[model samples]
Target chain A: MIEIKSLVKCFGPTRAVDGLTASFSNGIIGLVGQNGAGKSTLLRLIAGVYHPDEGEVLVDGIPANDAAAKAKVFFLSDDPYTPKGADVEGTLDFYLGLFDIDVDNYHRIIKAFGLPTKRAVATFSKGMKRQVFIALALAMKAEHLLLDEAFDGLDPLIIDAIKSEIISAAEHGKTVVISSHNIFALQRLVDRFVIVSKGHVAREGNNEDIGTEFVKFQAVFSSPINEENIASLGFRVISFRKVGSVHHVVLLGNNESIEAVQKAFNPVFIEHVPLDPQEIVALEMMLAKKDQKGGEEDA
Target chain B: MLKHYISWQIRKWWPMLLIFSIILTVTALYTNAFTTMAVRYYDNGSEYVPYYSFGSTTSNMPSLFIVGLVLSLVMSLFVFSYRTRRQSVDVFYQAAYAPTTIKRVRLLIGLAILLLSMLIAFLLGTTVFLLRYVSTPAEEIKNNIKFVRISVHWGMYFLSFFLTFIFVGLHYLINCFLVSLGDYTFDQICLLIFGNIFLALCFTSPVIYFDAALMKHGVLNDYMWYPALYSLGPVGPVALVTTTMEQAIFQRDVAGDFAVNAVVSSSIYALGGIGALAFNLFVPDPSGEHADQAGARNQAVAMIPHGAAAVLGMLMAALGLINDVSVLALSILPIFGFILFSVVYYALLALWRHSFRMKKFDLICYVSVVGGTLVMLTFAMAL
Candidate 1:
């Protein structure tokens, strides 16, 4: 388990992580955001790579940077480093010298991934390199594994294998926090979502809760449903599209408000369109952008 | 665990270590041969090669001192570069030990390697000399033994060799200071070159000039206050070695005075090195975030206290030198000067510049104020 308390990290004038506070229990957490959204920086802070400018990150009751706290966590960076002259076996030996890793599990994961254990990791392709680091992280059996871009540069089969391993790890009560731009991939793997925007968590919940909060609907009315009438119906429209008499609307609400919209329109045909994980996140980002522009204009 | 880590580091850089060891030994042997040739023309010269000195001071001392210094610097920088490169720091320290512990272990290991290398060089040089001496005629060997019996002792030679280790320690201290300046190739280069230059000038050139001045003023005749400046150069230690040799050869007692002076000088050097190492160990690695602003703040803060002290010290010392101002007035003036400079330079310009980002005009003002303060301090010191 990890807890962040009003954590703020600054890189020169830019605040990379701004007053972020959150708690993670033992589970698989998916961190999603656009580029430059502080997702990677947040993980680095939690891993104790960069000390915070203000506030604190605690693993259990210990400070994240403490030796004891650091012992429980492992951070697999976007580009993990391999020591000089180290092939797969040598690299494994090197890490064993530093940490008490499970050798049996290490060999098992290596075989499962089909990585060439004798070849130097520097010779491996980018995807193969990621696989090597993933195997090490899993074998280490650390209480907390913070993986940046966990599924990046991986083939479909490899992705499935890695996902299964992550699931197994989480099932054993290990905490795994994964950050990636691939929303659909995360949608399949993560039990909960943390959406970051402008160095802050814009939204956070289980996938079901997120789905309930954001909905998309399609309707066909006999008569024209103009902008004013749609506004009067009072479903906060995220996006609206019309083709002839049929209108597609993306909204922020649960089933009750979506139902109210259907009753108010009295359409010839009405269907609730289930949004995929990407669409839900995209809609939220659009809303946040709109609010920012609105605030700027008012000022 | 610490021992394992140290051994791992040593093995990791074994190739470089082996190369330097061979190079250092060859240099030492060549230097010893050159010194032996130079001393052959002087019939009264001692044939007893000082275990530390190896018989020739003028020809051999600088070269031997230099071998130790270069070996220490090269190894220190090599270890520093290997351990503190941006890539290594991020990866190696990510999951492992605390950074400070790693730094300490590397420093200790590097020092040990340096000492070991010097010991090897010394032993090899001594062996070569002994092999050459064995082939000399019995009459010549007897004559050489007489010289050795009069001018050399095991204890004096041991102390001579010990100075080389002290020089290595000083080099290590400088390397630590360079590491504290953040990880940048340009900064590292500047520090290494300038640090060597500074030490060379302090030990060699400045001492000669001071010696000439003292001789002209007959200040050497007053031994009481003269020892205060023993820390100025390599003079005191070098003189100690030379005087000990003279006392042994001539059956005199200049050893007591020169030995005390050398001890004071060496103590100052050792204490300075230890202080620098402590500072390097204590100062945390700079966080990249707001690094520029943080550096500026630190510089400003450091400058104020230093500037005030420099001003005060210079004023009092200058007044003392002129021999005009009374003791009471001299002491009071420096205190007043310290407060004035601290308020003007530290409180006003440094604080203001640190508070706000500088525009073109503001930058000009900041530079002017800093330059003006420096000029004033320089003039006062010269007085």
Candidate 2:
């Protein structure tokens, strides 16, 4: 288990991270935030690279800063910290030396990442570099591992490779924390998400909760659809478009409303358009903004 | 693999190594030419060398040799540092865990090679000094040996070579300060020169002043004050000498070689080393949020305040020429200012600029500041 207690980091007058408090118990956890939302800062604080200006971090009920606490946690960075001018062999030697990592495990993970074990990671492409870091995290096999922007810039195959590794790590009972803007990608891997906006944890629950409670419906009709009829169907009117005989309507709500609209509209073509991950991300951000506004109004 | 890391360091230095070798060869030839000229000149009626004087009240060769030594030493430091810092900090330090004793051993071995290079350079510097003012072609074997013996100890630059390592190593350790100015290449040169000049001035100022302390101790005690020069290991007050700020934190009575107690001043260099260690030991975990890269604050700052950066640089150089006591200590003063400026102003500008979109000129501003600071400190201290 890992815990963040009111963690804060400030850059000049602006806060990069603000009063973040959360805990993860044995599972795959997803952290999501927009650019500059302090997601990486939170991860770095946990990794012990940057000390929090306020509050503390704990590992398994012990101070995270302690030597004993650090041994169980491994943090993989968004951008791999490859030794400059170091070839692949030199980098492996370095990590193996620092972590006292076993050669068999290291090589196995290296092979798993599909990187030539002998080539310098510096020479590898950005995606390949991320793979190397992921490989190291898996090999460390620590009780807890943290990763930032774990999916950005990765090809689909590499992403799947990493996704599988996360699954495997979780299967082995090691807690994992991953952050990404790609909600759908995250939805597939993370059991739950901690949505960060304006430097605070705005939401916490399973992806299913967000998926089921907040849904998007798309219906196409051969006949022209009137706005009044769409309104009569009783679904929030997100948007509508017409192309010759085909009329399209998009709605957001629960399954019952969607089913009722499906029966009443009697559309020729009905499609449950999976909500864009970014759109859901935007919706969550709106919730955060609303929360802030509510707090301001109260104050 | 650790061996590869060390070799990479050495390879980075290869060009500068070649430069140092060339300088060493030239100095050696000069040393040989001058010493031979000194011997040959006295046997002839007139001197064979350009500036021949036998028993002058004030000597010229010591000054020349000191300048040559300082020049060569500073140059080698430049080469060593450029090669060392070219790699990102993460890569080099990642190798620290390579093996027990590997890091320290590599450092000591690197130091040895540097020491040998300095020794070769100093020998040539000595011969250059020896031939500067010769009388006849051959002054006789015994006469030349005696002359060489009296002034030749300055040729023992190897003694102070340890000091060079301490200073250069501290430069590597305190890369934060180096990175702050935002100009890695010029910033490093600035760092090496500023540090070397500060210590060199501290150690040599008293000698140039012919201060009362040295007058009372005589030339020999003056040598004692210079632990590196006297072949004395820093063990007590003698040990007060250091290359970094760490010594001052502990209040060690470091023996200052030139002006102030060298031991005390070396503490400033030690301070830098400790800072470097602290930074690496407490690396932050970014946890894969993925939008971040290592702080390129300098790159960000390079956009604003190019001229003020220039002035601050000028001020740093001015501090360099002050007496050894001041030079050794004051060299870092600008460093503190640079860090403070970066910490304070970077944030202000960052917030104001908030998604601070940077242009090329903005980046140039910081590079100028970094490069200019180094040049400023170097010449300013000379004054």
Q: Which one is best on DockQ? A: 1
Candidate 2 regions exceeding 4 Å error are A61-71, A84-86, A117-120, A215-282, A289-299, B1-383
Best by TM-score: 1
Provide the lDDT at A261 for model 2: 69
Q: How close is candidate 2 to the true structure, as a TM-score?
A: 0.55
Model 2: lDDT equals 0.54
- The DockQ-derived docking category for candidate 2 is incorrect
Q: How do all models score by TM-score?
A: 0.76, 0.55
Q: Please give, for residues B159-223, the per-residue lDDT of candidate 1 as tens digits.
A: 66666656566667766665445344433444455343443333433343344335445664534
User: Model 2, B1-383: lDDT tens per residue?
Assistant: 34654565565556655565566557555444544333223435564442322212112223323333444445434432322332222222222232113334334444455445555555555555455534433333564553432222232233343454354444444433333223234433443443333333443333433342343335334343343321111211123222222233322465133434444445654664567545433543222221122223443333323433344344344444334435444455656755554454344334323336545655556556665655555444344
- lDDT (tens digit, per residue) of candidate 1 on A115-174: 998889889888787888898898876799888988886788878888898898888889
lDDT of each: 0.65, 0.54
Could you report the DockQ of all the candidates, in the order they appear? 0.35, 0.10
